[model samples]
Target: MAKGLLCSAMQMTWRWFSPDRTVTPRRQLRFPAYTPNAVSLALKSISKKTKCLPFGLRQPDRPLLLGGHSLDIVHCHQYLGVWFDSRLTFATHVHYIRERAATRIAALKALSHSNLGALYSVLQTFYSYAIHSIVDYRAVCLVEVLESLRLSLEVLQNTVLRVMLGAPPWMRLVNLRAESGFPSLQHRIWERTTAVIAQLCRHWPRFTVSVLLQRTLDRPPNPHPGGDWILLAADIVRKLDATNAICGGPDLPDPAYAPAPPWLPPLIRCVEPTTAVPRSSFPAVLCQDSLSHVAALSTPDAAVYYTDGSVSDDGSAGAAFVCDEWVESWRVTSSVSDYQTELVAILGTLRHADRHFYRCIIIHTDSLSSVCGLQTQRYTDNKYLTAIIAVAASITGQGGEVILHWLPGHVGIAGNERAEADARHAATFPVPTFQLHPSLSLLLRRVAYTVRHLSWEDHQFQIYEGSRSATWYAIETAYAPVTVPHGTSNYLLVSLRHLRLGFPCCGQMTNSNPEPCPHCFDISEQPLLHYVLDCPATSRLRCGISEQLHNRDEPFIWQQRLLHRHLPL
Candidate 1:
């Protein structure tokens, strides 16, 4: 009687709700196991043996009975597209995503290793389409699952990078990253999730999810805390630039774009910022070495040390000390300046000599400041300089003399050239640990740049009309760890900044004003977009730039083409 009544009631409601349409009771009903006849048919279509009741909710003492059918009881089941279990641990789901992404990566290994030049775009597309989706699906919620598996995920990403770049697995992490042009897995996750949160706040003005985020953030980090999400969001806001995302004071008024002050990470502050190192105080003897001198000095008991430091375009720094007996490199923190790296290298070389019991030291370097500092500033207030000066004074104590030689860099002076190579290798090889602290302002500026570009990218201003500029792309995308030609990059940077700030392209818009373009008249303000894309005056010049581009033939491509016109074919 209960079975008959339930079926009759369901049929009546189904019919009433679908008066004009065909209501297939078998197709639409969720718990169709109520009908055993239909269950056999449904079981035949699906590969599963049985299905579980809903988990994580209260259950009744009585068994579910409908249409005289008996459904098996289980602990885990798929409901409404997501899997649910008795525990709700989400371990199964995390394992699935990992396996799925790894499988997709394996499928692309052949294409990744292929010599397909232009088809590399295809490989990237495949990654974006097949693998990134698997990795990024529901990432905001699954951040903890991903974070715990970060080392494994990084290996997966590195595997792809090695295959894509045609590099061996033993290649340095820095080199693989530079070749593949991908940030770390952790960084990508942060950027993606935060950007999504930023997008959500923009699109949905009144989402209650902000309240959940706020409550989670208000609490502290605990093993059983709200989740890893709180820690993740707090990490981005604290270490990365959280305050600038939204308007107002400390406790952000709008919780959407603005993340509140993180509870986990203590605010970053430098106790004592690095000061300028004074030049050495002692009078230094300069070594004027010819080919013959170099040859003679490359013999026994001669303690000649080569020191060099390198700063790349992206602001990464490295210092190297090379001698027949000792060689190693130190990666400098981003906050450290190029000049400081040079001094640090020289200082390190002096310390190395002191440790080895070498009574006499001969140094060859390309840094003028390194040579000058030791040559004159013996009694200086600077702490780093004072130590270096003491090292200089001590070396000459027991049959010890110091020869500070200036070698022309990269002109085949064997020792100096080796030091330079080692410096570059150090900069581009291992990841920097940032053990040396630089000034607070420099770190703040770097954080600001990251926030601005990320906001810019999230805003996707590039797609808007008349916003495309070579300078913007070159600055935002190519500026990180990628070297741009110095002169051209500078011109592009200045042109773009000027154009955005309403500085006139010609004479009319600024204090250093020029006459307006003859064709556009004084009514129109001349900006970078105007000259590159719209201005009739530069049409011929723009046409010539377009013609020079071999790979691209569009109007917008002209902007970047002209920007990089100085690049070699």
Candidate 2:
């Protein structure tokens, strides 16, 4: 009866809003269970299973009237590309994703041919943007779904990885992921979900989703059998140990007002080195000359201030501004990035200028990022930057002029040197807090650190469990620091990866029938090693390559040679 009244009210509301438009009953879905009585006409084509009643309750057969039309109920529906069912199991969605991913995986397979298809790197890029994007979309909402659903997604990822690498089904999943540098689907989902939760925590007041999340978290714990996304997110955060890293508090106001328009007279001036200034000039001399040039260019009455920001080895951040009349320094949260600290220094200078009603203010900073950010209006994304722009706009509105001068750092300009020292001191010894909220960059860094730590732990466990061979582990450890140089051919990368994994290209590692080396019929066992190092067929090439090595006297280890590690002198 309640559902009937709700339908009637919706019908009346729809007609009142749009008289010409009619409600489409066929598109609607009813949760938990559907009933035949809900429909006006007896539609024989409608399945009886869809209308199965809950708790064995039955009512007199009646039609659900909507805008003077009968409405039909559905057991499942698709909204925004995600399938939803009465039970909210997400099984339908997972199945759909697997089918969709299989289609793309087939396309990838078509491009995996050795000579006729696209490069491995190209295929990987396509997977990241095309296939992975589909699977990762709205994955945060699926955090609490059944383990089977999660495993299905994992299986989909594993299949894609196998197709991309052309790895045999016998290859272990851990080795496959390590070789490809792709984390497990579950880890990826957790990372993505944690990132979203961090963002929501930071901007809780700004977005509707954040507001809803905040409300949900504020209420008493109400356990749901299927589990709750918000609770799962909170648990993930706790596990990451990033509760303190979660940024909270309102964002700064937009600084796009007329007084601070992007077209406003050149406020930020970068000091470009000229041809007259020889590159071989002493650092101190160069800084002195630059300072003199800036002073000459500035207004005679303008108050010149030097601002600098610093980050200690321990990650504490500090910012300071030094002027003739007064000097101020602040110790910001360690999570605040060096770039943000630089902006904070500039912001302090602006606030000081505004407070003292300086007619002309010139702020000299060595941070080009901060200067560029101001010029490009990138301050909209950061609180300190936004505050800087706001204060600068206020100064400009009151018939005052503000200018920023970019100069080289650690070059010994007196005021800049003093500011730098004060910033260092502030960073070393905690001063008053400037801002407590962590910078977005720092939050992202923390999240990446947590994800990497977790991944490393998992990798170690895999190694301890004997999932990877010692030779494979040694190769991975050696090549961990090494990266493929730019412009490397796709064929070379694939060959190198195969070499690292000890893939049975030579058939010696195969369990069944092993084949002898084509070049050397005598060398049947360990054909890969013999082909690379012992084969007389490639002896001339090997000798030629050996002469180019730093130490030709030392024998080239297979691990070093195959992984392409630089030979020690």
Candidate 3:
């Protein structure tokens, strides 16, 4: 299963690899260009940079247009125009065009007519429309010049909207004759669009087109029936074209897939449609390349880090253990913040626990909430907490044990100090514009990609280990019960009885409301069985530990028996 997964990932990744670019499972090499999916992935990842910036423009470092031949470029240009025209429904086009005109008028009337800002704004709008039309719509050719003209409103709107809505206020008013004269300029723009529509009506065979368009531009009704009218027009067009095709006349293909240029190189001819439906069996590109998911698994052991969440008077806090480095990292944020915020960052790191060096798992944190939350059988309440729990399950499902420990915040521990600095820096810094470590970024991409394709049930289980040097298990045993020696512990014990006496057991009301157990049950005053056989939290904690041990094919019943025997019976 591991090998299959790794292979599938590599294959899918390689499909984006052009003839000149290749990825080897064994060695590191950079591809000159990114795949469409890679670009999409990059766009999605931009959220990690900062929330302030708009994510749409977060493009790949290299341009997608690079490396294609002139013919490929020409075809691409044509395809783009068709795509844009087809993708925007008629009503969308009308709405967008109308909106564009309004914005354009607003920008033009913001300042005096002859100002540099006015001229620049107008020219930029036209330039953007022209370029976008050519590159995306391939609408430059004049076989049906009227069709391109039909798209004029959409083009104009896109340009003006960006300038008017997206730019600074000063810039928006750059060409305005006077601030108060703005409404007049907008009125003039409406007149201009109306005149254009008049021209289309004069030449076009379709009278309904004019009426429908006038409905959009003239503001026919309160709800703006332009969109529905435009859809009606499109339906008419499609029906007319279908009738023509049935009559053995020139068969007009549906407009959605934009027809390619009538004249192109023979090589650019459309391939025959596939006879069989395309199955998503491992992409062929993935099968051809070799990548081993298990290879990384076999590499010299790396230390596992376990971080837990906490809340205190000072702020939200977290503790982490770096197994290989034998360091504990912990932090305390301002108490006002939510626990889940800190948990996201910590859980993100823990999910990738095997990436670091050393064979040990060291936990450093004062977050009893996080530790208890993971150990307990209660359903997580917070959305972020639930996500973290799912990820923890995925990690431990692979026979890995996360050793959670508590550390006093502000006590000046080195790892905790570093973590605090990192956390504070993360809070203050804007989302990164770009990741410095591309390799790590790529690894993250692979994991994310895998997650998307694989269901939660089929997710890979990664085993977590502690430090490799100097009898790490032996060192761990010093702090653990004697039944488990020089190995990962197989039982979880907590002071839950004092925390909630009957909350996990009876679900009964009490005279005084104690703080509810963060792990289990909803009520604060309910008595809980924290001692031996009955406590839900304890039972859950025991089950989780036993499952981990059983996954490793180790005898955990003995450990459970020991814990049961040790309980105050």
Candidate 4:
């Protein structure tokens, strides 16, 4: 009678099964041969055989083994049917626990001390295994389970870090229980708690989750707290949101062009920031040459570096400068308002820097105009000049100084060759001139001269109009366009106009500039075909040009022929 009652109670409590390992109704009569231990063992096996239930196991609409459900193996005196998924794997473990409980009770009756340790180990193994087996469940429940496992393992805490030291190491109790540590064990636990909540908050932004994070953060680190990992996670999330907002969202006020600040890492624990050593171009820095001479000059007295510029009537200029550490003052000389001379002198000084104490010296320039422009005191009018100024500023900004001196010109001075070479080179460059209302004859002559001079093997010229210029088959890349913008065009044309001639415009090539007209040397109305085929005057000029040419009797072709006839000049 007692056996039958035990079976019935087990069936009512957990829907127990029998040999077939399935859920079914229990028998009314007690089996005379069966013991409670045998029945319990059968139940354990049956639980293990069951399949896990789906996620909807808690819903009444999805129950599988209850109600009128019955087993197919009823005749074998065993219960058998499809078991609920919840009872699949975990049910067997639970049954194992119950079986152990009975065994432990029996051992206690025999006064066995070893049984206590065995039971503890069994519980520890079960907890660890069960936690690992669970998947995609509630994080809150997982945290609670972890807390329970921690409390249960308190008595054997010393056994943890010992076995796990180098392999999947666990936190040592000694490390966590440190005295006067900024971050204690308690602090670490609390931070980890917040981290878990924050991670979950990413998927589920519930009010409860936020509250949990706040609570965890409010609590200080335990005895072994190190870095605020949770705060780092939170800050990362915030930055992500901020970045998204700045890209397009309405919440961000800044433009996408503005740079963002450096990210504060969550794991940094008061380590010093690192700085890179700057690379020096001087041979001493790279070759590790002895700096004994230079090093001695570094004292407060230092040296003076002088620079000078000059311009001559022969269309040349010169500059000279010297740096002397003994004097502590620069000796500089150069002409004022001269660009080429000053630039050449500057290059010369840079090349012969080893001749003086350039490392510890003050620079001096005679041209106040050039010095002021170089030193940002004056406005820069040319892009190339601006680039030079920028380079000088960068160099001087690094603890060097450049002083200006107004030296008088016309003195037969030294260092004039460099300035003369620069001026001569600048003058050697072909100046551009264009015709305003130019005659067709004069235009054709000029075009012929330009094409032959600019062309490499192929005789051609790039016509310029407004801000645009086109290169027509140059013999080499050495050829550069000779044109200026409308504003600068006036300057080049001034002398040509005085001589009653035309000059090319020196405008920058812009997308809006009109294409050049090949026939009339104008982009607005003279395309290449029109110049070669349509121009009446051009056609009259070249009656018998190349026979293979498409435009045989065309005025533009005639013009091209006439232009070519004067190529030698």
The residue ranges of model 1 lying beyond 4 angstroms of the native Cα positions read 1-85, 114-119, 146-148, 202-206, 215-239, 243-569
Q: Per-residue alpha-carbon lDDT of model 1 for 353-400, expressed as tens digits? A: 877878657776777665655444232312344556556555654556
Error of 2 at 242 (Å): 2.4
Q: Quick one: best TM-score, which candidate?
A: 2
Predicted candidate 4 versus true structure: per-residue lDDT over 389-445, tens digit per residue? 443344354544433332222232222223333333443334411101211222223
Candidate 2 residue-wise lDDT at 512: 51
lDDT of 2: 0.66
lDDT per residue as tens, model 2, 1-569: 11211212112111111122222233343431234653444422222222221111123245433333444444445556776554567788888888888888888999987546677777889899879998678677578779988988888888888888877786667666766777888878887887787676665566766665566555544555246566677666666766566636655444453334556564444444455666478897778777777867578789889999998878888999998858999988775678888988988898888899998898888887887777664554677666776787788779788878777777878888899999988887655487657766677777777776676677667667775443454444442622465655556556665665656553544555657667777545666656766777756546656543324333224334544532211
Q: Over the full model, what C-alpha lDDT does candidate 4 score relative to the true structure? A: 0.32
**2 or 3, which is superior by lDDT?**
2
| lDDT for 401 (candidate 3) | 46
Candidate 4 vs. true structure, TM-score: 0.18
Model 1, residue 548: C-alpha shift (Å): 25
Error of 2 at 151 (Å): 1.3
State the weakest 10-residue window (summed lDDT) of model 3.
Answer: 1-10
Q: Candidate 2 or 3, higher TM-score?
A: 2
Q: Give all TM-scores, in the order shown.
A: 0.34, 0.75, 0.20, 0.18
Q: Sort the candidates on TM-score, descending order.
A: 2, 1, 3, 4
Clashes of each: 7, 0, 47, 49
